[model samples]
Target: MSVKNKVAIAGVGSSRVGKVPDRTGLGLAAEAAKRAVEDAGIGWDEIDGLLTAYSMTEKYFMLGSVMCEYLGVRPKYAASMVVGGATPGVMLNHAAMAIAAGECSTVLIVIGENRKTGQTRDEAVAALTTVGHPNFENPYGPPMPALYGLVAQRHMYEFGTTSEHLASVAVTARYHASLNPEAQMRTPITVDDVLDSKMIAEPLHLLDCCLISDAAGAIIVTSAERARQLTTSPVYLRGISEFHTHEHVSMAGDLTHTGAEVSGRAAYEMAGVVPGDFDMAMLYDCFTIVPLIELEELGFVARGEAGEFFAEGRARLGGQLPVNTHGGMLSHAHAGAAGGLFDIIEASRQLRGECGERQVNGAELAVVHVEGGVLSSHCTLVLSNSR
Candidate 1:
């Protein structure tokens, strides 16, 4: 029943991100998938299972099948999940479980989207705002930023977290992105720069918001035993867990406390490790406040202490725990559900020592956490280089 070290990530790949105007979502996915298959040193026919995340800009109903056809891989098991940002993590869990259950082997998980260039700004804003409850929450016409702004406001009021603390998160992300050659916004930014940026919502500025970019990422997962034959350096899935709190932000029990508390605890328990065991973390940074809150919920810091944790440069590279080393959604590309998939890819690369400058030295263990639907659904995954 325990899936600990039962599955391992053999390879990972990503398409050119940020303002990709020429390729459709599926095209990006195919590119990433082909690269993943190649990275794994396996033929396309070896992929017995396929999983994909739904596209916000694309109108395809059976995206999994569509991607299968586009990639020319007839997978025995295929599914397309739509869980917002958490879809990638959820899909990884499914792939591991399916492989463990003997339903399939060599599963390929891919997601892609052209959110930046495929859709108009107004259209994208309109689509995101639809997450609000039609009867109660949608009538006021609150966009996604407004919903997260409420949480940031509440955290500030409850824990005395200041706007400067939130800005520190943005500053750290930009710093990491500056070292990444493929990042969309590589320009370094300071906390002062973040605070001075145009305010999108109260306590949240333009720099605090995650960028809208086109991207695609793919990862290949197989049984641990099979993984060793495929790649000498496979990232093992040490533990994985998911928790659902609510559908809409209004239905959330606590604004500051999220499902990450429950899922993170479960994942650590499953992995037989604690927060200190992790060398790095890739938390969902849809906004600056998200990772700050997640750091507390994931037991990296005590409640009301995450603000100082980031302010002290504890989450930056060469710090105690380098977080979002690939810059995350804040500065890296965030292409719909594919955004979170990048976290998994980054973790695997860090473990493999593939990241050149921004790599965390001797990264043996990592924790990747992602949430969807305004922090409604959460999935926590613990990955390690050693089984």
Candidate 2:
């Protein structure tokens, strides 16, 4: 009778992840949607709901409606979400709620962008700077890295975390990416390489930051009843939670403590599971320090201890918790909000035992967490192969 077990991710799809200058945002989205529809084994017209995020390269009045029309499917419900990296997880929660509320049966969530190929470096930086407050933060001309840099600086100052600790996180992500053929950065890197990389912001080197790529991904959310009838591998949505703390990093109550603290606990409580119950995790790694902070907030490790955890190899594959096995945004392809959806896609694949070399053996339960807008908005999800 629980709605948690009632909704399942029936299918997921992603276009070629790395830079593709020829592909438009809409083209990538269409390709991913087609694959998701085929993977779900559902007719396009059968979809009753559609959800999407805005594209960095393309602007539209109603993106979800535009996407539905572009895909040749009209749905009873359509919505566009914008919450930076947390958009995908938020859309999934909304999709599940729409199904549980009887507003829609099958919901399709899609997002993508040509961030790498669509805009020049200056344009991309300018677009990203818009996330800052125009009145206060934007006047200072601080980019996203500067915002995250502030957090990293504070974390190090308060927790005594060192540059070496941050470098280990980048090393781990690149190592995992080496196993994933579809990953944008596949070459393995070491802590020394991470430290030697050009410094973007204080305490954050080039390797500490995530990649910018052209990518698109789609997901199918349907009732468990429908999912059972369609595919043998159905990843159930066990729990989900979303929260917004502040619009700008300057307005945040505490730079070190993100909304993940509240949302992660809410999601785990809803799913009737704890941190240890998850076999794998797909954390939004916009920066190396992000996963460290998020893992601490999620109670995967004690606060002020994530740096040591990474340094000790606790977050790597075959360790206590394998995080961002698909390399995450740090090593994987990040294309606007769609980059976050890739975390869910990878979690679904892990639960289904679809990841060949990167697969965590017997990974039945997984966690996908993403935060957006200078860690202002947060979303956490718990998924399991078993209901």
Candidate 3:
């Protein structure tokens, strides 16, 4: 039996990002879900599978059930996942499998959060900091920024990567954001601006981190056979893989190397494509150093060379391989864990030539990578315009 089954994304949608204090998390999700269902040209009754991700601010354990009731959907198969940042991409993999297994024909994947409006700054910090091991790590009270700062510090010490290299990632993402009207931070910035930003943690300035906002995104998955009957620009899921190396940052075998190394290899092998085959990459950029580390792990550039890759403008819009055309988490919007779903939506639109100014010319193949829990859990998806 072939490992790569035929599943395609028929439609994708996202709610208005940034601070929208008027809506709850469920409201944001419902808005995006409605758009996705409409875009797919399928009625709500056709959806037989539903998947959702956890929200730190929302105290709902049965989020899948709650979302179903809000959206008026009763799916035969329902699941809620909590894989941190990897939720979106991992959900895509699961939804695809369910469709391929004949368990469902249409699946809806939704994720969002009202982090900015729902939780105070202190509350948000406290909640995210708990991702670390309570007994061994959380007692020290290392915030997410500090944990990633340690990773950045280690990368610089071992590979001679400087703050300028990290700044380049921020600059590139901001440049892309300037083209995207829906992006949170649309103002273009330079490396000097990134360097001048306030320091959040050692080796990580404010710009080095992602923006916080209230946002939600969704996508509809169905069989490739069904997709042909729906949209003319269906984006096929050519390859997908996910893995977790550790639950906490302290448990990671190595701070510099993430699960992207393993997941990227598996996804590429299943897709029968190399890193160079992709026209663009929508990499998860929760922190600036993340993309550099993931680029190296995914074999797009040699270890320690990712610094030079970004410094030389290789990651810019018209560079060798455009990355994060929708500006990514850094400059776009990070609504709790739902940030990863934005990457998938942007990639699907790019494949369909829907990204106007930021579009990569002749883009047929693209890669979407999302990581969860301080770079512990990883998911990679290879999408193509042609089946």
Candidate 4:
């Protein structure tokens, strides 16, 4: 059964992002959860279900139970979900389904990590590459940047997407971050600056990569009927869908054409809205090319034209459709799995008109899309303030 308008986000919260060496992953999660409960005007005891994304920096095996013990919360339903970067979106889907199935109500979703301060630079890089195929991709010793670089290179070759177009994405993200007080990198950058930045992987500059950060984010979801009693500005889950293409980049069927094509179509169909129905978007920006490719795959822009769409200032604030209004992973904090959770939080805040300087005007609808494991898994969510 379609979950359209059945589940609604009642509240959202996030911890101090960027670098925080003092707090543990569980500590961050607790802080964010408390804030979320407060934002929803509900007591901690009201949360019957809890869902958390697995922590890569932390060594805890049963992170869900560990977090429950740490927070003094005895949830009837709990789980530690792992789907790479797609965990947050996937978890949201599961939360909605569980609530619909009468398993529990008032679910709290949280994720956090201290990757920036907890791990050495080498360790951080190594963690990203561990997802590579053990036999074929791992033997080559390619880091995450190299994997995304290959995708960027392929897009350029096939669609005439230029380096300047990639730089535009970074520049836009930085500009948005400048308006976000919680963003990691707030300094506005130029396309030339991105072009001149040190190269990590060929054709992909350091600016093209997302930041490693220590951060946490949380969201509270409940049945739509219950959401109205909790908050007047509830963001309803209008559409949600997920698609898995492969585990590794090498196994992907097509480099440019991602599973977003299928997932986006399904989500739109479920929501009964097209791409034009969205007032804003929160496309995952793990790399510069990701959102550009997603825009095409999600039908936001014509294929082979996303590069121009971004380069022409159409994706920025006051443009046709503002994207990544909270700076996104490119300039915002990206704390492992929490990076995608931040996307959902930002979209909810935008719909609620809570964003101070970076708010999208009259944002009634938003589309949030995230991919994991070298674009191997995809999930798309369409959120709205109205039913």
Best by lDDT: 1
Give candidate 2's whole-model lDDT: 0.91
lDDT of 1 by residue, 65-163 (tens): 988988899999999998889999999999999999999998999998888899998899889788898988999989899999999999999999999
lDDT of each residue in 1-387, candidate 3, tens digit only: 223648999989999999989988998998899999999999999999999999876788898998888899999999899898899998999888888888898999999898889999889887767877999998998888999999999999999999999999999999999999999899989999999999999999999999989999999999988988999989999899998998888788999988899999999999999999999999999999999999999999999999899889888878998899999999899986689999999999999999899889999999999999889999999999996
Worst 10 residues of 1 by lDDT: 53-62
lDDT of every predicted structure (CA atoms): 0.93, 0.91, 0.91, 0.92
TM-score, every prediction:
0.99, 0.98, 0.98, 0.99
Provide the lDDT at 331 for model 1: 96
The residue-level lDDT of candidate 2 at 72 comes to: 94
By the lDDT metric, which is better: model 1 or model 3?
A: 1
Better of 2 and 3 by lDDT: 3
Clashes of 4: 0
Candidate 2, run of 10 with poorest lDDT: 1-10
lDDT of 2 by residue, 175-202 (tens): 8999999999999999999999999988
